[model samples]
Target chain A: MLYLIGLGLGDEKDVTLKGLEVIRSCARVYLEAYTSILTVRKETLEEFYGRELILADRETVEQEADEILRDAAVSDVALLVVGDPFGATTHSDLVLRAAKAGIQHHVIHNASIMTAVGCCGLQLYNFGETVSIVFWTDMWKPESFYDKIRRNRLSGMHTLCLLDIKVKEQSIENLMKGKKVFEPPRYMTVNQAVDQLLEIVQNRRELGEELALTENTICVGLARVGASDQKISAGTLQQLSSVDFGGPLHSLAISGCMHPLELDMLKLFAVEPSTFEQINIEDSSTYLS
Target chain B: MLYLIGLGLGDEKDVTLKGLEVIRSCARVYLEAYTSILTVRKETLEEFYGRELILADRETVEQEADEILRDAAVSDVALLVVGDPFGATTHSDLVLRAAKAGIQHHVIHNASIMTAVGCCGLQLYNFGETVSIVFWTDMWKPESFYDKIRRNRLSGMHTLCLLDIKVKEQSIENLMKGKKVFEPPRYMTVNQAVDQLLEIVQNRRELGEELALTENTICVGLARVGASDQKISAGTLQQLSSVDFGGPLHSLAISGCMHPLELDMLKLFAVEPSTFEQINIEDSSTYLS
Candidate 1:
């Protein structure tokens, strides 16, 4: 049997009791680390679970999945992933491989960031669509994600912007040069992502595209979610771009039409809610303020 | 100081080590119950954490804010949320209240469903906008969310559909009649949400509005996410509509355009990879088959 477990977000202790039990019973445990990272380290998890965990990077999972699935053919193998097993499409492939081989598998679920965005005091029901913002490279600055966020906001839905994280990713030059060079791990901070978003907004503005994203747009920044010392701050997009959230692993939310209550809650997190009123007078004074 | 901690999507053990340390040190620990529920009960968590926990319902948190915040004003009080502290926005109000009352507070993070959807083999970066699918009532079946999903799908961005959960809510008739009757808890399952989505799709089809959703469109169903018994099944929106994922808590993903690699991963989860053959077909098919 192949046991696919969700480690929940954060550290080793975040694994479900049932998942931990499965891990303990499994002959081999592999932690798929590329898709997401927990706030805790591998050593901390190993100490608590009392099992040696092999760190499975993107290459291990994507390029060498056969080895991970090799033992499952004979014995119970557990592949632990942060968040729900199906939260990332990567594990779905593992499930598929297990299915193709006719190996019975079980999935252990856990909280992922998708449903957890509600903690920012926005109504879960009111959110429109979530989008991801990637690191803008000099050669590849794709604004496609921006288009989606723009549409979501136009329809009055809150947009949760997932920041990018590059783990063990090779630079294009390295691949072309065949140098096997790897860049340092980079987790997009909420501040940096906001800066890129602002740049895109400016680009669109120059092109006369009537985009909703602006410097003073209400935005929420979250850092080190599911870890101790998680930080959440609400401010204008401009404020967020400058405000240091102080950590790796960050996310940003550009709220759409908010409820009166949501606006009130966001007010406390604002760096300059007073100045923000100029851009959103009706929402600021008429509804929430 | 008040520490709002997310327990994540699973049982008691899902709490991070950081969160646990805080819980052990805090004077009061309250679990927010209305927004979401953990697979393990309070007793289960108490047994694991070796600390008693107070389950705070919406009433306790919202109505009795004064009481919950009283101790926080003086010392450390930990408010535990099921997912990430900001996952549900419910805590934002609490956080705001604490801020206004001159109470210092901190947030402990946990993996939330927001970022966890990446596990489903979907490209986290490919997702366009996240939308919420609410439990439809006989009187209040709003289809606005459909528009948002349609918009996202049109733009070839995956949509993360957050299912609804209603707890401690009053019956409409009972409330209107001034009776103290309560309704049973209602968690929007994957099947029911899909059924409604299909109905809305059919409605749009009749109205001559080109809908991005169709019966054969690819969708990923998630249930009991972040829990030990989590299940993920990939199929057409039609096939998914008939699947009874079982138990409380469910989410759905309507995939849009896929990158070559993403399409490859998604095929691994599909009911029939051949039916999914159209997925970036130009890419090498030899390895996929």
Candidate 2:
């Protein structure tokens, strides 16, 4: 049997109890190291679960997946992921391979960042399409995510922006020269991500898209979610661009036109809470004021 | 301090290690019972975590929220919800209430059904707007979700359809008559959800909308996700509508035009795997064959 278990977003304790039981029972366990990740280290999980885990980096999975599923054809094996088993594309590939290999499999799900954003005081049902903001480079900065977010905003829906993480990624020059050199792994910070977003907005404006980061466009920034020091701040995109969220694995939410209740909640965290509370949403006058 | 913890999707063991620690330290623990739910029972979690838990039903949350958040001003409290802390709208209300009470709060994220569907061989980044499929009744069946799904499809994006869960809901007549009564909770099955989709497609066909659920429109049906008996099957909607997925908490994925890798994975699970694999997707002749 092949087992796929989710280790939720925070530290060592983020893994489900059932997942730990399976982790302990499996003779060999592999933790998928790429995709999404938990703040805890492998040693922490090892100490609590009382089992040593082999980290399966992107190379291992893309190259050695056959070996990982080979014994599953006979005995039980567990492949643990940092979030829900299917939260990333790599795990899906493993599942497809398991199906092809004809191995019976089970999945133990856990908390992932996808649903955890609701804690930032935004309605889940109100969220539009989710987009991932990747690290911008001098040669390869992409603006596709900006288009999706823009479209979602036009539809009056909340947007959940997943920040990018580069794990064991090779430098462009190293890849072209067929070298084994690696670049430092990077997790996008909320501030850097916002800077890129603002740059995209400015470019779009130059191209006549005409949308800019506005004070009333309400945005929420979360840092080190699921950790003890997880911080959530709500303000405008312009306001958020300057705040130091102070950590890795950050996510941002571009909110939609607010329901009275949602606005009330957001106001509680604003620099000027009273200003938002007095808005008479039923009339256009309040928005103009 | 208030902590919103996601229990993830399966049983009680699905709680992350971090979530468990918070639960252990919380002065008051309330499980939000309205949104999504785990397959495990309260006693099961209590036994594992060694703590008594209070169940916060819908009425208690909406009507007696004061009691739930009362002591957060002085002590640490935890509110648990199935899936992620933000998977539903009700949790947003709870977070706002905590803020209004001057209670500092943190959200511990978890995996939710929203992104977990990425396990079905769909690209997470390609999913567009998500829609909820409610269990339709004679007088209350609404079709607003159809438009949202249509909008997503038009944008060339996959749609994540969240099936409805009705727990502790009161009958319309009981509330009007001021009598205390509640209906047994119901979880919509994959079969029922697909049937509604087909109906909506038929309506669009009559209206001359270029939309329909064809025999070749690929789909994935998942049952009892994160459970030991979890099942995943991929085929056309027509074929999947007849398959017995078994058990509650099933989710469906409506695929868009596929990338080469996605097509390759989908072919592995096709009912007619050989025939599907033989086709050259870029060549019309192969599809015609």
Candidate 3:
């Protein structure tokens, strides 16, 4: 059997009891390392699970899937993923391939940022479609996610913006040169995401489109969710762009319509409680009791 | 400190190692019994955890939250919730109150239906706003969810309909008589939800409104996700309504535009592969390569 286990958002201890049991019994365990990074080191997880893990990069998983599934028909083989197994479409594709090969497989679900964003005092049911914000280059700035946020805002729903993380990425120059060298990993900060969002808002305003957010628009910044030192801060886009949310794995949420109760809960994380109150008054219709 | 731990959607062993550690050291542990249920009985969980659990129904958690948060300031107190701790808004409110009361708290996130629905081969990012479908009564037959599903369908996004479950509910007759008796627990089946949805579609058709879904619309029915006996089936709404999902806690998904890859994945669970192929050809635009 091939087991796709989720090593949730935190340290090694976040694995479910069932997942741990499966990992212990597995003959070979592979950890998909490119999609997301765990807070703890690989060594820490190895120590906790008492087994050596084979690091499977994107090329290995995408090109050598047959090798990964070879012995699964007779013995247990586990592919551990950060967050939920199906959080990424590639994992689903892997499962589909497993099915085609007649290999038995099971998924052990765990927390992903898709649901952990609720820790910022936002209701999960109230969130509309989630969008990802990729790192912008000098010539390649994408504004498609802005339109999604607008649609969600018009519908009075929150939007979760997953910040970008570039892992094992090759430089364009190196790609042209066919070099196998990889650049250092880069994680997008909340400030960078907000700056890109504001840039989109500016371009849209220039095109005479009504905007969903502004400098004073309330937003929440979350860093290292599901970890002990997790930090959540709520404030306007302008205020958040200046605050330093230490470390990687930051997420931002653009508030749409809010219930009074939601506002009350969010106020606890406000950079300046008085600013949050003033914004609530300026746009009273945005919040309902 | 107050610890809000999630018991993932499975039997007793689904809790994370982190959550189990917290529960083991906590002075008092209370399980919220109203929101959702674990597959195993309370006794099973008790045996696995080696500790008796205090069942906190709606009243205890909502009205007497202070009681649950009482000794957390001095000693560890845990409130166990099925699925992720913040899957419901009331839990967020409880966390907010804990913050206001100067109590330090932590949330141990776990698998939630919001992400676990991916087990049905539907991509998580393709899902739009999720809606809840309640059991329709003669007087309170709500059709608001139909509108949400229509909007999602129009946007070419899948919609996950969370079937409502009634626990510890008192009937109007009993309430009127001032009787303390409670009604038997009721969980909405995929069939019941489809019936109500079709009723709304019929009403909309009579009103000359364009509809996004019909009896022929494709849907997926999932039962007891994350459990060993978890089942997933895909077919038209008419076909799925006849499927015996077995037991409580069923969730339905209305398919919106599918990627050819998604269709391929979903085909593994099709009620009839030929019917699925015919539907794909008839509504080719609903899927993109």
Candidate 4:
């Protein structure tokens, strides 16, 4: 039997009771570390679980999944994932492989940013398709997510922008030379994402396309969500681009049509309470009644 | 401090260690019962947590919210919600009210069907806006969800349809007379949802509109997700409508354009192995190589 457990977004204590029980029963445990991350350190998790964890990087999981599944047919083996097991497509692929191999598998679901983004005061049902914003390299900048955000905005739905985290990445030059040296881990900040989004808006302007977002567009930046020190600030794109959210694992949300109550709730987290009134184009007073 | 904790899908054991700790520390705990429910009985949860839970129905939550929020400013209060705390907009409204009352609050996130639907072998990122399918009444049947599904399909994204569950609902006659009588709990099954969807497609056909889905369209039906007896079946709409996915809390998903890998994974759960080849319009043979 194989258990794919989710270590929910916070510290080690965020694991569900069922997940903890399964982890304790497992003969061997592997932590998939490359996709998303928990707020606590690996050592903290190890201490809490009272078991040693084998770190499964991208290469280890992608190339050596068979080894992890070898003994699962007879004994319980657990692979812990940061968020939900299926938050990333690779995990789904792993489950499929386990199924094909005739191994009994179970998934213990936990919270991921997909649902936790609701903490920003926007209703979960009102959110449209979510998009991921990757770190822009000089030559590999992509703006496809811009149109997706536009579509969501046009439909009067908020959009959740998942920030990129580059871990164990190799430079293009090193890949060509077959070098194993890896770059330092980099997590995209809300400021960096905002800058790239602004650049895309500028390019679209040059191309004579109507802008989906502007400098005064309402945006919310959340950092270290589910943690005690988690910070959420709502402001315009221009204001958010200069705001420091502190630390890694940040997310951004572009507001669409806002209900007056939603506007009232979000205003409490605004950079400046008056900024909402100054820049919000929506007639929020209509919903006050 | 007020703690809004999510009880992930399934039984009491699905609650996170952090959520459990908070519940234990709270002086008073209220379980929000009207929005959604767990597979286990309230007694099961009370036994597991060793805490007596105050059942907060829709009327209690909506009309008597102040009672729930009272004393939170000086005492620890926990409002337990099935799934994520913000899965429903009313929770957000509650949070806003808490803020207005100057109460310190925290949200403990948990797994929701929004993300757990990935257990069906579909990538979460590929899912577009989610729609809710309510039990149709003789006088009021809404087909707006059909348009939403069509939009998602046109965008090449899957659509997760959240089936409605009516608990502690008052009948129209009783409500008109201000009676205190309540109706029996009713949960919309996948079969019922598919029937309504097919009826909508038939109506569209009569209106000379091109169909976005048909009886042969691939669909997946899931019941008691995240529970031990959780069941998932992938088949054509017609086939799924006849399949019995036992118990309550069912959900449906309409397939959009499928990646070959996704199709492969979904085929493993197909009602009939040949059904995939017969109903899948996409050329999946190319993916076999």
Candidate 5:
């Protein structure tokens, strides 16, 4: 049996009791470490699960999947992923592969930033399409995600912007030199994401285009969600573009039609209560439950 | 401290180690019993945790909230929710109440259908706003949710329709008599939701109006997700309307634009492979990662 388990979005203890039990029963455990991350160290998880985990990078999980699935027909094997297995970048291909190989599999679900972002007070049902905001380079800056956010806003729906995380990636110089060296992992902070977002608005303005997003648009910055030290702040895009949200694994939500209840909740986390003066909060007190 | 812990979408074992520990440590533990449910019984959860459980129906959580938060400021208290704390319904209001009461609180996130629906081959990021389908009566057949689904489909994004569950609800007769009698729980099945959906499309057609949804629209029906006997089926809306996906807590996903990879995964659970003939699966082979 091949068990694909989710370790959730916090420390080692975030793994469910069932997931931990499966790990104990599995003959070999592999942790998929590419798409999402846990704030705790690998050693901490190892000590908690009482099993040595093999860190499966992109190559191992994508290229050497057979090795991960080997002998699964005879004994149990587990591939633990940070967040829900299919939440961030999906591992359904691997599950499909296992199905083709006639390997029985099960999925253990856990918290992903996808839904956990609602803790910041936005209603999950009100959120529109979620978009990923990648790290922009000097020569290559893509703003296609902006259009999606605009559409969501136009529909009076909230947009969740997933910040990019470049982990175990090699530099262009090293790739050209055929070096195996990897640059340090980089997680996009909400501040940098806001900067890119503001730049997009500025560029569109320069072209005399009226976009739904503006510097005064209301946005919420969330960092280290589901952790003890999790932080959430809400304000206009311009107001949050310079404010630091502390550490990594940050996400941003550009809200559209907000209910008074939502604004009331976001009000508790506002950087400046006065900045909310411009937000047009909808009156859904009669409907919001 | 007030701990709003999510018990993932399964049995008692689905609770995270952290959530379980907090429940054990809490002076009183209340389970939110209205919005969602776990397949396991309350007694099973009580036995596993070695504590007597208090079920908090809608009234207790909404009107008698002070009773729940009475001693939360001085001692630990937990409100265990079925899915991710903020996934199905916005618990932010309760959290807001706690904040106003000066009670420090913590949230333990867990798997929610909002994200877990991706397991059936849909991409989480491609999903748009979620809508709830309530059990319609002769006079109360509301189809306002149809507009939201149309908006989502217009944007070429998937829609996750959360089926409603009526637990501990009072009938009009019982209410008028003031007998305090409760109606038997009625969970909206995928078939019923589809019937209402099809009816709406028919009504719109009668009115000479166009809609993004139709009998031939592709969808996925998921039942008892995260359970050992979890079921996932995919086909055209007409094909899936009659299929039995087993017990409660079913969710339906209406697909918009599809990627080939998504089709491949959905194909494994296809009710009839021929139904895929109408789906224009996009070639995202080069970009999907």
Candidate 6:
């Protein structure tokens, strides 16, 4: 039997009671380490589960998943992910492989940034296709995410911009040199994401393109969600670019039309509640049922 | 402090370890009963948490919410939700009120249907704005959901249709007479949702409107998600309209463009895998990171 468990977005204790029980019973436990990270250390999770964990990076999950599923048919094998087991398509790919290999599998669902973004006051239902905001290199700056956000905005839908996290990634120099050296893990903060978004706005302006998002557009920045010190701040894209939301795993929401209820909830986390009063929030109450 | 904990969509054991601990220590534990439901009885959760659970229906949560948070400033109070705490705006309303009253609050994130829909093989990021499909009445048949799905299809994004569950709702006639009687809880099954969807498609055809979804369009029906007996089936809208997915809490997903990987995963749950071979699945490989 194979159990894909979600540890959720918080510390070790965020694992559901059922997930914990299933993990304890599993013969081999592999923690999917690359996609997302929990606030606690790997050792903390190891101590809580009372099991030595094998870290499964992108290479292990993508290239050597068969090894993880080898004894699953006869023994309990568990793969723990930081968020919901199915949050990333890679895990679904593994499930497809498992099904083809005739290994019975189960997924234990838990919260991911996709839904946990609701903690910042934007309703999950209001969000459109979630877009990933990747860190840009001088040579490889991409702005396709802006187009997605624009599409979502056109439909009056909020866009959840999932910030990038580069773990065990090789630099172009290292990759070409055939060296095994890896860069330190890097997590894009909300400020960095906002900067990239604003940069796109500038580029679009230079190209004489109509903008769906501008520096004045309302945006919410969230960091360390579901944690005790989790921070959420709502402001304009320009304002959020300077606010420091300390820590990793930050996410930003580029809101479209706002429901009065959403506007009310967001005011509680606003950079300046009074400033929101000055901003015209087109009511989307008609859309609410 | 008020602990707004999410009991992930399953039985009582789906509660996170942190949530269970906070719930056990809470002076008063109120389960938000109106929005959604878990598979087990309230007694089951009470016994698991070793605390008496007060069922907070709509009236209690909306009208007497102050009662739930009145003592939170001095004692630990928990308002347990069936899914993630912020899955509904009602919970966010409670949080806003808590903040206004100077009460500290915490949220424990858990899987909601929004993200758990990924189990059907469609990636979460590919999903556009989530839409609620209610049980249509003779006088209140609304086709707005179809428009939302159409917009999603235009953007090549999947649409997650959250089936409505009516609990402790009063009939319009009863309300007109000021009756205290309540109707029996009714949940919208996948079949029922498809019937309404198909009805809309027929209506659009009659009106000579552009159709974004049709009888032959691929859709996935999910029932009892995250449960031991969870069932998933993939078929066309017409095929799924008759496919019985036993019991409540069913969700439907309308496919837009399918990634080759998504197509493979959907085949595992396909009504007829051979049927998918006949469909031209436009590859969405380029959209994936």
lDDT of 6 at B206: 97
- Candidates arranged by lDDT, highest first: 5, 3, 6, 4, 1, 2
What is the RMSD, in Å, between candidate 4 and the native fold over all Cα?
2.5
How would you encode candidate 2's per-residue C-alpha lDDT over A1-289 as one tens digit per residue? 8998877777787777788888999978998888876677788888988989989988888889898887898888999887677664446667778887898667777766666776666677677778889888888999898887778777777888989989888878999999988888788887887888878877877888657344445688987777777777876666677888776778998877567767666676674554455445422221221
Better of 3 and 6 by DockQ: 3
lDDT of 3 by residue, A18-96 (tens): 9999999999999998888788988999999999999998887888998889878888899999988887434866777
Once fitted onto the true fold, the runs of candidate 3 whose alpha carbons sit more than 4 angstroms away are A88-90, A281-289, B281-285
Q: B38-147, model 6: which lDDT tens digit per residue?
A: 88899988888888999999888888989999888999998989889887434877888898899988888999888888888888878888889988888899889999
Residue pairs with colliding backbones in model 4 are none
For A1-289, candidate 6 gives per-residue lDDT tens digits of 8899999998988999999999888899999998889889899999998888999999998999899999788999999998898874448778988998899889899988788888877788778888898999989999999999998887788998889999998889999999999999999999999999888899899999977888778889999888877899998888998998988889899888778788788888899777577666432321232
TM-score of chain B of each: 0.92, 0.90, 0.97, 0.95, 0.95, 0.95
Candidates sorted by DockQ, descending order?
Answer: 5, 3, 6, 4, 2, 1
**Local distance difference test, candidate 2:** 0.75
Give lDDT: candidate 4, residue B179: 98
Model 2: how far is A10 from its true place, Å?
1.4
lDDT of 4 by residue, B179-227 (tens): 9899999989999999999899899999999777777778899998899
For residue A119, give model 3's deviation from the true position in Å: 1.2
Q: Report backbone clashes per prediction.
A: 55, 13, 0, 0, 0, 0
lDDT of 4 at B196: 96
Indicate the worst ten consecutive residues by lDDT in candidate 2 chain A. A280-289
Regarding DockQ, does 2 or 5 come out ahead?
5
- In model 6 chain A, the worst 10-residue window by lDDT is A280-289
TM-score for each of the candidates? 0.78, 0.88, 0.97, 0.96, 0.95, 0.95
lDDT of each: 0.75, 0.75, 0.86, 0.85, 0.88, 0.86
2 versus 3: better TM-score goes to? 3
After best superposition, candidate 3 residue B154: deviation in angstroms? 0.7
